[model samples]
Target: MRFVAMCSAPAPLDQAAIRVRHTLMLLALLWDADRARVDLAHELRLSRSATGNIVNELLAAGLVQEVGQREDGSVGRRATLLRLKACAAALLAVDLGASHARMDLLDLRCRTLGTRTVAHDITRGPGATYSLLAGLLEQLLLETRIDRSQIALLGIGVPGPVDHDTGCVVQPPNMPGWDSENIAAELGRLVALPVLVDNDANLGALAESRFGAHAGLSDLIYIKVATGIGAGILLGGQLHRGVRGGAGEIGHISINEQGPVGRSGNPGSLESYAAAQVVPALAAQLRATGLQTRLPDPASLQDLLTHAAHDPLARAVWETTGHHVGVAVSTVLNLFNPQAVVIGGRLALAGEVFLDAVRASAVGRTMHINAARAHIALGTLGAEVGVLGAGAMMVDHLLTPRGLPLLYSIARRAGQPVAEATPLAQDAASRAPPAVSAVYTPHPSPPRSHPYSPRRNT
Candidate 1:
């Protein structure tokens, strides 16, 4: 059930063909044109001829086109190329981080058209965050002059655990008023479009895989070390959104029982010692030990981190912080044999100091095998990642297992009785498909062979 991309092009057939062409062209670019088709065929296990046939079908469907030629050092005529047209489809994206929210307009090519950010503490007063988002989105669309109907999908990336299926944010130990918020339903109603949501770390991992440092890699982990720490895990080339979507809370791993009790009541979680808030107090304690330091007054955790990088005592504080972070990350390394581990967020900005301890602790504690494939580095996406991630989250949801809005559309058709609809839905369900399957699953049992008639199968 492919979406027919709406085109502004005048020629009807050409318009549809161009839309399909653009979509496939974009995918080829993402897949790396030189190697992708071959890889795709290999992955799909289609022989050259069969693959060529499918490519022809895609061309016929207006989803793709042969654009150029590729030479694999063969003697005869080279293989023709395929690529997608980028402007045929569009998506909507939102990123809700601890400090702010950002909205973006994206095309099917994964190219960004417009973006707007509402800068405010998301953990602030009740309704402040969502209210800010409501206005921000309105202003962005207005400013960009983009039509609403052009947006076919909406994606959001929240700062904390989200029920992957429902897009609801679970109670964040740090953000007090966010629990019970029905993000999906509310946003769905606001935009009149399909809404998809996931946690920020997961989105960061997605960003890395789709468009950043870990691009083309099969197994990678994206770690963001903000006020709190988290990990975005990618296993076998896909995100592992654990049961309830709350799987990436690496900050909650208990590192010190004797340290101050953290938000979730776990004594000495990784966050307690490594979070921005705790660094200053630890620096202050270092000062009390008769060590001269510049960290005299700590207003923001970032301030302490800045001093720690230069001042000896502050460096010591970071060393300790890194140790704690390392302990927690070591556990993760042991558990996940990832190809890369990306460190991000405010804490990661501490650069080498923070990473050294994490690396030392991890290497010392983890088995050789666990640490073998892992490569630790900072995030390459920077601040834009959160928003980009938010946008990407929606795009991923729309493109993944959860297919399109066909069922909903089928339901809305006038005079289509429920009895008549059951068979259509079941037939669609029985032929399980990838990506789309993530979006919707039909009834497990056969539709009553006839909805209005007595069932004969039973």
Candidate 2:
């Protein structure tokens, strides 16, 4: 869900051409519809002649098309409207959670062409899970009548720590027997597509930033509270994976030294105190305290939620859990001072009762200046956020300057690498003579001294 901006010192004409193409792709994606030539020129800060030339190149490549003309009120002649050919390529996206998997086939615009969800367990090990995934993908492709050759990329999100460079699971405490499994490699082999993998929370944050409530925000955090708890952090408009891709592991953060040990062997961790696994225990304690009766002890988080509507005790338990969540989030707000905090996952399904408590506690515990600048809200994407995020991740990668050639090579060779792909990309760039003078200027890097000022929500 995170993107690393490509930055380099002065480069050759070929490299500059790649940057121009990258900028055009970004503009097309953001515009989402036909845009006039003048608007494109203004947005990219390129001269009209340069914009026209680049647009012509894109038109020749079949990546973009002229969709008639825009009759503006200006005295000048009508302007041609250009839009991205969203259906020119497709991507496969998967969301692998602790107890279920969701797969989707999406077009370049991240629109779902087909999708399937199955209940499965990660505890069954990588082999079983992957086999299921392969079968589901095959079925989805068949159902959608999408040619395998058209699938340009695959993106997956897992509920565990991922070695970002290798796409391997690294000792995920919740997913037994998943350690060291190179999921991307296995999945790539099964589908013969270039694959990318990332943490589910991170993907959720990315999805939110691009398509959900926080779209266009530069600083935000997404907290997932479900079978476990994790945070997806976005700072200065990019994902912040720590040294080991464990930046937002708020669930494992020690909240109380004297608290019970969790699966990670961490005592009094946030997950140990407030995750779904503790719901039954909380229900039992409430029952033992002779509070208003619920059938028997709540067997699951769902039971707790179902009872909360009528049982005061169940509501109190949710409030208490929410407060713990709020405390953890308050710490996050103080440190990152993000513009918004999105609460998601199964726990969030409990609705406003849970979110209200979290908001109250977080605001009360944080500095007024920090709390005042932040807005905490339930995730708008609901259960589909992870899958949507996976799609967005692939779109982000494939549209990049370097990724464009890789995408073409994959399509040409059924996901096999073409040794001359880079050269092909350079050749394409070289053909755009008008862009030779349109140097790509990277976005200015944020200052390193203090927290960034909150960006206005778009």
Candidate 3:
């Protein structure tokens, strides 16, 4: 299931402060570069006096800094330029995969200060995995000379489904012995910080939505085709995790009834056909059929892509796999009608030969109305996407209205408590939006068996 990290809104009496803080943080984040108080006031649609009050509070809290002044052409007055203190705090991001893990230390602006990748196995279970990650995190802190107290939060991207609220791995097919393991709590204990967990693909989607090729789009999908297949869905400018956080398990969708079964015990699943594991297996199957080719008998997806330049058989396999993936994507297009479909992961490294095939097939199969509107493209973030996404998710959560209070609480723990301030003006308070909770919570039952058939909430 997909995990979100923000809590539901509190009572109306408490919302004014939350809304004012939330708006200030969002403006600071999106503005990225230095902006003027007048611009922030205009963007937030608040009076100059109100905007200045919020800015003053953020400045007092060490969240924002005024750097120099904006010299407009007019001779009237120079506007002071304000920007977020990008280095004020740090975040820890972990991308846990089936065969490897990537850890990164990022500043408040989600800029990487240090990163390291290590080979590991998730099937080794949570204890071993958590220990390995903790060690890696400690190493990073040492290398970067970042104090433990400087870390504000932790974001983790697991290959398997997670119980977002509890940070538990929930009956993941690829990760044995991980079921019901409270990953967040365990890691939080080690690092002494609140932790957020989510599917790796979902994190990738979030990263791409905020900073990658599809940065401005609200409706998009990120499909990661690696050792396994997964999709990250963004709809209506927000991540849609479904009722149970299983909203984007397109890999389990059956395409060929006679094809090989997947970990979900489903035959002809998309993952069984398009994942990195499938390339080698499909090669072996082709070789057994006495197919003449320069491609190795059992080749990695990388090896096949290299040979595809000279081997018709290797190119054919990629083409066929891409077509199969496209069929699944076509179904997604028909359903979600996203503005864009971004293809990522190891297999996507095969380049246009593979992407072209996916696009051609998906366009051919999808209805013209949906197909015409969706732009298919490759992901731009490369190997760092997952970690960046995780970091971005954490940052986004911490900047929310409810998250602001949590941030203050974290600051208190860090021995840098921010002083309380008066609430916003009555009219501004009345205009505050209701709280929308996105934080993960425990599910009532264990994750359902795959191929999971979600009941569509109409």
* Model 2 TM-score on a 0 to 1 scale: 0.85
Q: Residues 148-177, candidate 3, lDDT per residue (tens digit)?
A: 777778899887777654567778877889
After superposing candidate 1 on the true structure, give the runs of residues whose Cα lies further than 4 Å from its correct spot.
1-31, 34-81, 124-126, 400-458
What does the lDDT read for residue 331 in candidate 2? Answer: 93
For model 1, residues 130-247, the per-residue Cα lDDT tens digits are: 5676677678668656555555667777777876555567887766788867677777776677676677788788666555555555577787777667788877655676766778
Off by over 4 Å in 3: 1-32, 288-292, 408-458
lDDT of 3 at 112: 70
TM-score of 1: 0.74
Candidates, ranked, TM-score: 2, 3, 1
Q: How many collisions per candidate?
A: 20, 0, 3
Question: Global CA lDDT of candidate 2, please?
Answer: 0.72
The window of 10 residues in a row where model 3 has the poorest summed lDDT is: 449-458
Query: Which ten contiguous residues of candidate 1 have the minimum total lDDT?
Result: 449-458
Q: Give the Cα error of residue 449 in candidate 2, in Å.
A: 18
Q: Tell me the alpha-carbon RMSD of every candidate.
A: 12.2, 7.6, 8.6
